[model samples]
Target: MQIKRKLTEREQKLLQILINERNKGIQEIAQLAKTDIHDLKTIIDSAIDELDLSFLNQNKEIDCTLISAYNEKLKNIEHAIDRLAEGNYGSCQKCGQPIPEKRLEALPFALYCVNCQKKKEEKNKEATQRSYPMREEI
Candidate 1:
C-alpha cells in the first residue's frame, strides 16, 4: 500500500495553530458557561422574592449560543484537518476549484473558494429577505 504524504510545512503549522486555538476556546467557553450556570442559580436563590427568572434563562441562552458557535468552529477545524490529510485542503467544497492562497492565509479553515462563498452568502441573504404568504387580491 502507498503511504499517504503528510501536509506541507505551512499547512501542518496552520492546522496545529487552528487546533490549539479551537481547543483553548472550547475549554474557556465551557468553563464560563458552567460557572454562569451556578452563578445565575445562586443569584436566583439570593433574591428577596422578586427574582426575574428570565435573567437566568437569558444567561443560559447566551451560553448555549456561544457553545454552539465554538462547537461549529471546532468542527470546521476538524474538517480542515481532514482535507489536509487528503491533500486537498484549499479546494472549494461547493465547486471543485482551488481556493486562493490569500483566502487560505486569512481563513485557514475556509472550505470554499471566494466566489462560491460569496454566492452562498448572497443566496442566503436573498432567502432571508424573501417575503412569504402573499396577500390575496382585494
Candidate 2:
C-alpha cells in the first residue's frame, strides 16, 4: 500500500469547495458561484445538447440514452475525486506507478499514467481494426 503524497491543504480545500458547490442544484450553485443562474443553465443545457448531438447525430429517439451516458461520465468523475481523497490519486491504476504531476495538474480525474493510457489506447486500436492483412506476392 503506497502512501501517495496528499494534496496541499489549500488544494484540498479548494477541491472540496468546488465539488460541494458543483453538486448543488444549478440555481443555488450559480448563486454561490457568484454567476447568473441563466448563464449556468445555458452552459449545462449546451453541454447536454452537444453530448446528444455527438452521441446520436441529431436523432431524437436516443436523447434520453445520451443524457444517461453523460450523467454516468459525471459520476465517474466523482468517483475519481473519491479516489483522490483516499490517497490513491496520481498513480496508474494498471501499473501502480506515480503519474506525472503535469498530467495530474491538467486532468485531476485521470486514472492511468500517460504511458499506460497510451499503450491501452493502442491495444484497443489494434484489436478493433477492420482491415484485412495483405498477402505477399510470389
Instruction: Give lDDT per model, in order.
Output: 0.62, 0.57
Q: How far is candidate 2 from the true structure (C-alpha RMSD, Å)?
A: 9.6
Local accuracy of candidate 1 as per-residue lDDT tens digits, 12-92? 666666667556655655465564545644543364134333443546445665655655665566666666777767778
Error of 1 at 3 (Å): 11
lDDT tens digits by residue: candidate 2, 21-133 = 33553544344444566765566556632422243344454444534454555455455566666765567899999776667656656779988999999988876663543
Q: Clashes in each model (backbone N, CA, C under 3 Å)?
A: 0, 0
* Candidate 2 clashes between residue pairs 3 or more apart in a chain or in different chains: none
lDDT top scorer: 1
Each candidate's TM vs. the true structure?
0.48, 0.45
Instruction: Output the number of the TM-score-best candidate.
Output: 1
